[model samples]
Target chain A: MTPASLDLRPLFPAIVVAVTGLAVLLAQAFTPKGGRAPAAALSLAGLAGALVAVVVIAGGRGRGAVLATSVAADDFALFFQALILAIGIVAVLLSTSYLRETATDRGEYYALVLFAIVGMLGLVSALELVAVFVALEIMSVAVYALAGLQRDRPESQEAALKYFITGSFSSAFFLYGVALLYGLTGRTSLALIAQGLRAGGIAPAAAAAGVASAGAATALALVATALLLVGFGFKVASVPFHMWAPDAYEGAPTTVTALMAAGVKAAAFGAFLRVFLQALPSLAAHWQPAVAVLAIVTMIIGNLGALAQSNLKRMLAYSSVAHAGYLMTALVAAPGLGTEAILFYLVTYAAVNLGGFGAFAALTRSGREPVTLSDMAGLSERRPLLAAALTVFLVSLTGVPVSGGFVGKFYLFSAAVRAGYAHLAIIGMLMSVVSAYYYLRVVVAMYMEPPVGEDPWSRVGTGAALALTISTTVVLVLGVYPGPLMAWARAAAGSLR
Target chain B: MALFQAILCYVFGALALGAALVMVAQRNPTYSAFALIVTLVSLSAVFGLFGAPFIAALQIIVYAGAIMVLFLFVLMLLNVRTEVRAPGEGRVFKLVAIGLGALLVGEIGSVLVAARPALAGGFDASARQVARLLFDARYLYVFEATSILILASLVGAIALAKRDPSS
Candidate 1:
């Protein structure tokens, strides 16, 4: 398709999110105080409409380079659009009750959530470097605000400041990397860059021999790749760049934390997969080993960090980091079944992490932090359903059989092994064993330990319960019957090239 | 004409550097802010010397004008007292600052010299050309996305900074 005649039919989901975000903002302005329920209802309706649009578009013929070749409407992008929209719906549901309990239930919260989803949808579809950067910034700015949503909490403010500062630093690096890549290949479009590299149009030797020499150009490209890696690394909360994740996750509202752990990480991985596997596949020999090492380090460090955490939020934060490592292993093995593996893992991971956080949100009441291990003491006695749900989630997180996480991990490790990275898979399995300690620790705290004091069995709002139930159902279904989703994921992965 | 441009570039560049030095040297926040304005204005002048008048104007309007004003207002609102440094502390800071500054200058000088052959031709940075390119399909997405980003930031700022009446 020509750029001039770029079709926008595939952008229906993103357009829905953008319009819904603005409508929510306008509604917020017009709605009276204590009308948070209506605003939330409106947001939910908008997300459901977006979800419908995603399904319809996915059923249509997948295409490439929509909106003037800036974004692709391929199945890969559609998969992420659907995943992010689903996650956004659940997050909004969780937020409705949590915000109400905390007395921060303003319409702006829902509006921001919609805007963040717009960013994610755009990010997954963006085919050009400039568009990627813009979408990245859009997502980052919205999340930064969400991280600091609790105005009265000093920890929240600190979280926002730290995330914003570090996030901006990474953006700068990413921008510089884009500049260097453009200089090397004279193109910003991912497909064109790949074509140029494959055709020897931007040969390293030719670049080295030129005025700046082939060495300089090649060096620039390498530096650019490193910078982009750092940028994506920070977003996915990989080991060395993950210092902000624990604090940010711990400080944000539980619902927001769920969104960060599930939606944001998935979106980041979506971008990472597209950029590294689609655009720079020619340079896989250089990047694959580096990424594999990062995966190993991240897996070990994230699990070890979680083992030392007394707070449940902090432990989950570290757990999210460890999961990022697992996903990265798939990326490192991208030439094989890595792409499909990562997609399956992301779907499972999103469901389990969101469900885990949703359970935590259900237990949280206004004006109190019930996140400590002791705070969870005898949780089974207090709230049997929540405890049971949390148990399921934790079990899934530990990759136990009969859960979605197990299937996801099996796919990822087998993909690595099939790709001749059995060592990585071995390390990954060992780390999964190490992770079980912390995941089961929470279960033990809930089931075996006696109550520290009053059970703190506050009522679970309908919205939160719905979110938790949906997440739990997704986890269980994917675990039991992974056929349909695996087929979709494989198709989506095939469309990437 | 080329000779005149070169002279103008050196003058404005030196002024910018001097202003930056003064900004960092000032102990009082207000004075530091004023020095920052000077640096921004001088940088704009340097941009003008490079034949980017539009960017120069934007530098003044956005950075030296609005941003500096905001900085000054925040400084005044906070009313932070001037910090008193211990004798060796300030000395050590100055020494480290000077060393870093020297290293930065050396790096820049080497890069410029090495890249001189590649910089033989200069591209036009006229407003009309920049506008045409920016409005082209290739860049239009980024431009629109940037607007969305700014809007999101505005919403976030208000959401975080505004006080809750219920609280």
Candidate 2:
């Protein structure tokens, strides 16, 4: 509570995001017509600087710092901060061409994206329930608006509306859970709650308070847990709670969708891991079953759901949902391996999704949305490099050899197996197989189908193409040699507070 | 019989449940949104009766005040007047929504009832204690989070309202 005790170093990443966001806004204000490129460059530069700052501050292997009970700057936070910043960088790169083509190339677009990333970083680092809720709102509201940034596009508006309603409802559920939790434990900090729960049986005086004390506090805790689960489930787009994902993904600009699937989901998973693993560990036996069921349902539903989608973005959305299920399986199989598995899967998933979406962004021509599977036909014949890159991305998503997704899934299933949930792993793997069917379907259309008239791949900028190429290469590199990353993941997961 | 206290609890709980039901079944979204606000406010009152006065006040202030206003403004702006015209009309989807809604309600209900044993004596001077804790200890974080929320809102509002430059 002392001002001297407030270690501001832990807040550097968040401050960097905020300052960079402001810089982007100011640059947007000063920039003239046709100056979107410079604005985007500046935003990208700011994000890169923030990324560097986060690394430099949190780069050491130790727990960097803690800002009272509100935030922590440990390996877990640094990992997510890095992931979010990386996603922001890719989003900026994707948006450069996307905005230029759509003729909605406003400097503010990049600024909003940067601001969303700022929120995302805070969401990951926050250690208090209140702080997490506010960070989530900041992130969600920004993305909701960005989804409909192309206001003239009906689909964009529709995406934004659906996302906004569902998101608000989820926020209410999350806050209600927080309230219930506060009532039950008279606290909100995860660390304090964990300590309270473990101090030899719900406090001595609370026990003497008798029957009402036992039932009410326990009931409130359980309700809070369920609400929190639902809230996070919606954010991660798990099945049975994933209706908004496809519409939002398909309707939003591809870059925004990428940000949602990558940055937002990663942050949500971080919160999910932190809350359940930290505050509710004592109730693991009770909640693990619920999570297990959700995992199975999400995997099956997300994969089957993806089976019929023709739109690439919609398919990827379903794939993202299925991936959440897969990740949830790891979370459910919880002898502590769940945490590490989730961190690993999230890093791999971010790279793969960004790569896939980057490829899509590269294919999109001016005045035309290249979302349909048919629209991507004969890509290999027309734009060989882009087609090959997309193939790598899809193959990686399908868990093929030497791709990050493959290693990611391997880590998850292995973690589940280690937790004595081999059956869950089997079911998850089966769902992965089903997901591969849809992800590969896109690949087949890209290679097998004939070109529909003149290909517009020539219109894609070299920088955009380079981004896709780098993403694809990263996917493969991480897949083949994931040892270092896994080591980092293990350390980060262990540091869960 | 402790008539005043028991009667208050029953009355407030009944109002909360009633408003919640109205919120769920109402055809008009604006009306549904309004019903939701009422439910939230009454829930806050219920929390207040339970001695979590701060939570109750926050419930009314945060959810009912800021959140619902935003919801209602969007509803009015978007003119979501007709239930039938609401997006996602597929029968299967509706069925899923209903099923999920029922499950959520059931789960929460069961949990609440199960944990009912833990409730102790209601609020007795904890309001000032909690407030003091929040301000004296948690003020800086709250300030930071509030600033972030405001900035996000400002950016979001502008983004949502801006006209297309190309148009």
Candidate 3:
């Protein structure tokens, strides 16, 4: 076959997920406990296959094409595809031990996880409004079920309920925004929408109408932007729209939380980057100030709210919100940073956050959930390696040296500074300082306090431990030498225009 | 044909908006579920008006007829209506949410005004015309992508609805 004909490889990542999803379902039906190992192995193999496919497709630039106007199977898609697959793999690894301990281990559990990964990959790659919405629904539905996967726990049902209610609400907003934007541009394609806006042939009479009738095309555009932002804000747990996150995160299984923090956050940001940066660039003047305000509120509210939280998951939920603010700052400054900074921050954020959650996942006792800060006391003494891994993750979250979080924050702040939003950068820096206190406090609890009755160290699994170690190692390595990552991020971001 | 199309779009859009308003305003969870069904149905019609006949049909068949029914069935199965008699959250928060809603509406209105100039000829033709446009060589990729999304959704739904084996 010619090289062009041979280049059917890049599309395998999506196909791999589909195939694995089916295999997992089959395993659930036909496989026994001893056979369960094969399901896990198959999932890992599939995820690895997808990740390698992404790398190959990304390497063979210009070989990938948009499946239609609705999906771009290019470097940008591959970058996010790789992130989603990695997060999925880590989640699967973390859950193996947790599930085995609870006797909740089943083939369907892995299958559901594969399905969730399929949704996430679909979300990252989709380019059209309907496509994104469908992908999001698929992802949300699977996760809602996953949240309640622990059927024995009432909290799991509660978390699933709350998430479903809020998620449906957000979906409504997303759909409405899609409708409004379609009304405004008559096309669902972001590129076409942008082109139409740039052409700027709107009649002036439309501007003279009342607030509802403001017939001003910009009014509809602003409404659409606000609606879309609300939907994404809920997903990323930005302040004012983040009330559901803490409760949901606390109630859900730890492995699922890792997926939420890493896969969902990355996918949401991916969609946000694609929609706003590609379609609404011309409306920057209208939306920038609003985003700046949101960034500040999210940062302040997230950090301060986390202060009173005794629940570790809840605190981390709030911290995730705070981080969303920092990422939003990067997004707001996208005009100045040229998109590279936002993409880089997402990658680093995924590594560090997933690492922290994975570490937490390993420390759980059978039939006992990890919720309280006090529950983790003296962890450094009992399980030094896991503690060290968690510490590294926490430090990375606090933007400490030699961690991916540090590099991500540095790029975000620098991007804002370069964008001449010096004030926003300063605010972001101050919030990071506030954030450091909570992350460090976790470290203090681990090292300084007496052990809680019995050490939970022996319960940690090799797979989960491996995930944490690899995540922490990647975070540190990326922090110290980010040139290679920065180059790819720049290339992907440049392709947006 | 133009007048009929305009009327159809308006009726569907209005019905959808009205149902959404009822869903938000209704205090009873059961009533809210009923309103949601109406809203979903209206939205499906709105999709039809936009010329996406297949998607519109799917919206009704899947979202309104099946998904909403499933949601209602779940809600009933939980039998939570009596347990959650009180408002779900604090009154002050609700008020603030309403205020934010107003501001959001105003902002969206402003954006609509700004964007109106470029909307000319955006919807000059019906959904069938658009579908024809979609099948053309240049637009073929999107058709395939949409199919993939549908397939993924099917898999996802099955995965989610499957029972816990350990139970």
Candidate closest to the true structure, highest DockQ:
1
Candidate ranking under lDDT, highest first, comes to: 1, 2, 3
lDDT of 2 by residue, A161-264 (tens): 99999999999999999877765566788877767655432544444433245555666678888999999999999878899999999888888888899899
Residues A243-262, model 3: lDDT tens digits = 88888887778788888888
Give the higher-DockQ candidate: 1 or 2: 1
Which candidate, 2 or 3, has the higher TM-score? 2
Model with the higher lDDT, candidate 2 or 3: 2
Q: Is the docking of candidate 2 incorrect, acceptable, medium or high quality?
A: acceptable
Q: What are the per-model C-alpha RMSD values against the true structure?
A: 2.8, 6.2, 6.6
In model 1, the runs with Cα more than 4 Å from the true position are: A1-6, A33-37, A61-65, A198-211, A450-453, B1-32, B35-39, B79-92, B117-122
Interface RMSD of each: 3.3, 3.3, 7.3
lDDT of 1 by residue, A1-497 (tens): 33566566756787788788888888777767655437787888899999898787777664443677787788899888989999999988887767867777776788788888888988999998889998998899999999999988888888899899999998998899888777778788998877765554464433543524545555666777899999999999998999999999998888888999999999999999999876787778888999999999999999999999998899999999999999888888885489999999898899888888888777667757578888888988888888888898999999998889999999999999988889899999999999999999889999999888765645788988998889888888989999899998999999887
TM-score of 2: 0.82
Off by over 4 Å in 3: A1-11, A32-37, A61-64, A201-215, A336-338, B1-167
For every candidate, the chain B TM-score is 0.80, 0.70, 0.65
TM-score of chain B of 1: 0.80
- Candidate 3 chain A least-lDDT 10 residues: A203-212
**DockQ (CA atoms), all models:** 0.51, 0.34, 0.18
Model-by-model lDDT, in order? Answer: 0.85, 0.82, 0.78
Candidate 3, position A193, lDDT: 78
